[model samples]
Target: MTHAERAADFLLDEARTDWHDESLWQVRGKRDTIVHAIPEWEALRQLGSDIKDNVLSNLDTYLEQFERQATANGVTVHWAKDAAEHNRIVHSILARHRVNRIVKSKSMLTEECHLNQYLKQQGIEVIDTDLGERIIQLRKEPPSHIVMPAIHLKKEEIGQLFYEQLGTDEGASDPQYLTEAARQHLREKFLAAKAAITGVNFAVAETGGIVVCTNEGNADMGVHLAPVQIHCMGIEKVIPQAEHLGVFTRLLGRSATGQPITIYTSHHHRPKEGGEMHVVIVDNGRTEQLGREEFRNSLKCIRCGACMNTCPIYRRSGGHSYDHTIPGPIGSILSPGIDLKKHGDLAFASTLCGSCSDVCPVKIDIHDQLYKWRQMVSEEGLLPKTKTIPLAGAGTVLSHNGLYNIMGKAARVALSHAPRVLVYNGMNPWGKTRELPEVPKESFKEWYARTHKSKF
Candidate 1:
């Protein structure tokens, strides 16, 4: 197996532990009750999903309209077809400004495109300003959770990481003290950075502005303080108008962290007085995804991450297990489209419990996408050898009543004396951590004939 596959398998193995998986499942349930308090919750979700769908369907026209409007407002707009194109566009902007050091707010697009590494390779220094992202960055690891990237690391682990990296006292483990220490350290970087890059949470097509939601005010601080500000957004992130912002903002934080809303929701219309502003609208396979009717709705994701927080598979396996920048249920569905053969296993990682679909603020039908991706991936010959034949045979048998009855009888008889361990081979992914259900003798149909039919 390849390194990526091993990492994925290891994550899946870890997810099978009951305590680990069930915790996130509870978080999902809690979020549902919170959302249920609002009567228009379902309507808001449909509206949000509809808006995104409309924008994605008319993506080219909206993108062009956004570019024209953004340009008219004195904000430069650049288009990138892929990751390399994205990096070059960003690098060019930074190079033009002679910016070597940058302070960045949380932007998943950057992580997805490996922007930090690319900037480092270009001899530019980048600092992740989000507290969770900062800690993960200092440790040289990818963010483990979407909103709380450092969720996997305990306070003690963070203190240790900080003490080693920031030259703090050896055992300082208090969260407040550590937070202040990081604040002071980042304060210096914030004051010094010539440029700042932020991710666009929502872009308003009507106004030609970008909306960013942040808790720490880092995105505001970075963009407001820096001489030059750059914002990167997926092409599908554009909303029709500013009026729609209220619907998304209401759902975003409540679904994500259970907060009523994030502390700061900043809109950038033009550059800070005399500062330069640029927006890099990225396609990066989003348009291709939009072309698929069955899967296009996945683009409605507001990145609330409630799906991840509530996902049993995500909690058990953790984000790093996905081996992609975006992790959890959303990542599993999204990754296969980017590279089907390499990420094929991710589609099968879920139990199809539909919990993720239930928690999504925008109601992306995440579980449905996961299911569709499985069929599409299998058709593309991405299925691993062992799964292909048996599942296909089962499908064929289940389609015919007589064949299924014969197969059921044979299976029950074969399983009657079979060793428990034999049923759980290495080939069975679920068998690694979960016990197989015991097989009972005689078919339900046969039992019904023996009991209910005679009575009738």
Candidate 2:
């Protein structure tokens, strides 16, 4: 289904829609406050953007460099050209180790590759240790938000989920209680895990180290306990130097959750004694995306989610409507690159508001990329006739001055004198959630001629 159709389904719940919108806005406000406190926030964003651009421009060199350094640090590295290969490589490692169960921290890359489902199919039990991830895993739902995987659900909904799955109290809905319950349940999973998997937040070529930023330290716990550790990262994740990490660290937490820093920024350099560490660097269509000059800048995303929190369209529509691992404005641009035909409608799911670009920590031109995707989709004859036919007629009217003026005057007259029922019915999508403005007596062109003619 198209994003609009799914979004319509989400909007059916009026109270939920309002709550989601307000909740994201509150996070946006928090970001504004925390970011302003940093005197060099914009500078940091620019630096992060620059570093990502440099890395994208020279990904091949950095990826090789990282592999060399990581190998020297006693870390085994595997390269996968696609998701299938990445999943196979990871499964092969588990199959070799004869690992029956694994615990994982939140990793959008794993979500992108659908790794958990793959592992489960191979009969290797997979448990997501992150609280939000665990909640969604038990419910068998994809994450609705990147950082807050269960943000789409309410505490009451969670209480019910826990009641059924975790055996919580009949009506217990307190955050602390639920969290403790999750922690205890996950602790068992962690200790029993034969292997652990994490997503790499950043990989430094200089030191052959990867960073995992988390508030709960779940990644650390899983890695520490599990004898076999796997870290999955996209090729774009590699940076040239360790120093470049500072720029992203300053911008990431603030943009993602409006905090000065993540509670635990754990750097995994190598394995513990008698333990094994594996880094899986997967292309998974990233190389193709980087080849598109107009869209290459999108690789600069730090996954801070500032754009998602600030986007008006995303704030109201909810992330599930996007139907991609990454959602919101950034996903609109990225998804189309992966499959234009299936995701074409996503580009039009925006107001073209630059708020997303303004808030992006790495300064990706998200809205501009959305516009480019829209042009590509339309040029490919991907838009349905319902939109194309009306747009074609509007284009004709807009191109001719006389036709434009006539249509403008007709609209003003109809809006002024026509019955409210005629104006607010099924034909008017804009009227569903908005009021028509007061009609002006004259067209701006007409007023301009009358007033400016004398002056000229």
Candidate 3:
């Protein structure tokens, strides 16, 4: 099994833990109730979706318009068509300013492109300022959650890590003291850093300003404090105006953490006094994804992370299990676009629950996209060859009644001799941790033929 598949297996194992699966299912239920209480929530979702759809449809125009406006505001705009180009642009900007150390705000885009590793290779020390991201960074692990990078880790684990890395006393495990210690440590990095890099939540076309949403105010602090600010954003992040950003910001927090709104929605129209600001708009396979009608709606994502929180698979498996920067339902669909063969199994990670679609701030039909990705993956011949036989057999069996009955009889006979572990090990990802059910001695057709069919 591939890393992605292995991650899914681990998550399935986690789900088998007593009632943990039901807890996430409960979260989905609560989310629905909360959203239903707001009369205009659906409308806002529709508006956000339509706005993003419009922006994507005319992306070329909006992108150029944003460039012009941002340039007029004294911001340098750079375009990168893929991950390599994006990393090169950021590295070049850092080199031009002679920046050796930099602080970063939470940015899934950077994670998506593995920016930290790239920057480290260029000899630039990059520190993640987001609390969760910082924890994962210290651990040298990818974030397991989009909103809460270290959600899977308990506070004791964090205390231990802090004790080891920051010279804190072994017993210093209080959330308050831990937060304060992190604050003090990151503050020093922020103050001494020559440059800061942030991910853009939304870039306004009308004013050419970048909008960032954060609860901790780290993004604002990093950008405003640094002598140089570099903002990396996906091409899909552009919106028509600041007013348009309001719609997304409103829905973003509610969906992400069940908050009314994030504490700060910082808009960077200009760099601080004597500082230079640059924005790198990265394609990274997003443009090609936009042209794909079935999957294009995936681009409307606002990264609120509500879907991941509500997803049963994501909660148990955590973000790292997805083996991608952005994990869970959204990552399943997005990863294949970046690397078709290696990441193909990601598409099969979903249970088609549709809760992700329901909680999406911009209303991307994530479940549909996952289904579409599976088909696309199969069409591209990326699925494992060994599994092809059973998949093909399933298709044939389902298509013909005669074959279905014959297969049903053969399955019963096979189950009689098959070890019970084979049921646990075959066809189900859940078998990684849980025992599979025994096949019935007779099919439903067999039962009906002997009893009810006699009357007919």
Candidate 4:
């Protein structure tokens, strides 16, 4: 099914859809409130954008520099060209360590690579230690949102999930009680974990350190306890210098959750004593995306999720509708770059209102990129018949001024005098939610000529 069909499934539950919309909009409001108080928010965004530009422009030099410095710091760095190699590298390390069970913090890169499923097939019991991740993991569902994986689920649903899986009291939906239940449930997994995996928020070339940001500090716990630790980082996550880190850090929290900073921004310089620390830098498709001129700016994403929080379509449709690891406006652009034929429909799932671009921490031109992708989709003949047929007619009418005017006149006549059934029917999705203003009898050009000719 296309994005619209999947989104229709989400919209079937009007109550849930409205609640979901309000929940994310509340986060967006919180983000606006916190950011308004900051004196240098825009400046910080510009600085972060500049730093990312520099990093993307010279990513190779920085990667080699990072590897050298990291190796010097007693950290082992491995490179993977894509998801298969990435999963293989991770599984090989686990097999070498004889790890039967492993714990992981919230890692979207791993989700993109489907690492948990791969590990499970290899008979490794993967436990997600982050509370939201653990909820979805137990339920055997993919993350709906990048930061809030279980945001699509309600507390009552979680209560039932915990009741079934964690043995919490039936129908106990209180937030604190459920949190305590999760804490007790994950503690054992953390203590027994043989290896821990985390996603990198930023990797610094100057100091050869990787930083993991989280509100729950699950990544810190898993890394500190496990003897074998792996930090899975996308190649685009690298930065040029340690100083460039602060700019992103400043923008991340306020834009993400209205906080001064994430609760735990842990830095990993080296492994724990007698433990193995592996930094797996995987390219999956970053180089391919970077080579594309129109979409490369998306690499600047800090994963703060501010754009997702503010996006109207994402708020109402839910992230799962996008059918990608990272969802919302940023994902709409990035997903298509990876497989335009498969994800082409996502490029049209927006209002092109630029709200997402406004809230992005690193200032990615998200909506513009979505529009570009839409054009690319049309160029590639990727649209379905429903859209392709109408757009073909629209193109002809819009290209010539005379044809556009005649079509406009015809539309006015139809909308004005046609039967109600003709105007409101199965084909017009736009009329489902709202109606247009009354059709005018005269065109703007005609009105201009008649009204202003004598006076002006």
Top TM-score hit:
2
Quote model 1's TM-score. Answer: 0.91
Candidate 2 has its poorest 10 consecutive residues by lDDT at 242-251
Instruction: Name the regions of candidate 4 deviating beyond 4 angstroms.
Output: none
Model 3 stretches astray by more than 4 angstroms: 1-5, 8-33, 409-456
lDDT of 2 at 248: 81
Per model, state how many residue pairs clash: 1, 0, 1, 0
Model 4 TM-score is 0.97
Question: Which pairs of residues collide in model 2?
Answer: none
259-333 per-residue lDDT for model 4 (tens digits) = 989999999999889999999999999999999999999998889888999999999999889998999999999
Q: Which rank order by TM-score, best down to worst?
A: 2, 4, 1, 3
* 80-113: candidate 2 lDDT, tens digit per residue: 9999999999999999999999999999999999
Please provide, for model 1 over 241-324, each residue's C-alpha lDDT reduced to its tens digit, 9 standing for 90 to 100.
Answer: 889899899999889877778899999988878899999989899878888788888888888889898876777666777888
Q: Work out how many backbone clashes candidate 3 has.
A: 1
Worst 10 residues of 4 by lDDT: 420-429
Cα error of candidate 3 at position 147, Å: 1.2
Model 2 vs. true fold: TM: 0.98
Q: What tens-digit string does per-residue lDDT give for candidate 3 at 268-377?
A: 89767898999999998888898888888889888877788777667666566677788889888888887878778888877898988878888888998898888888
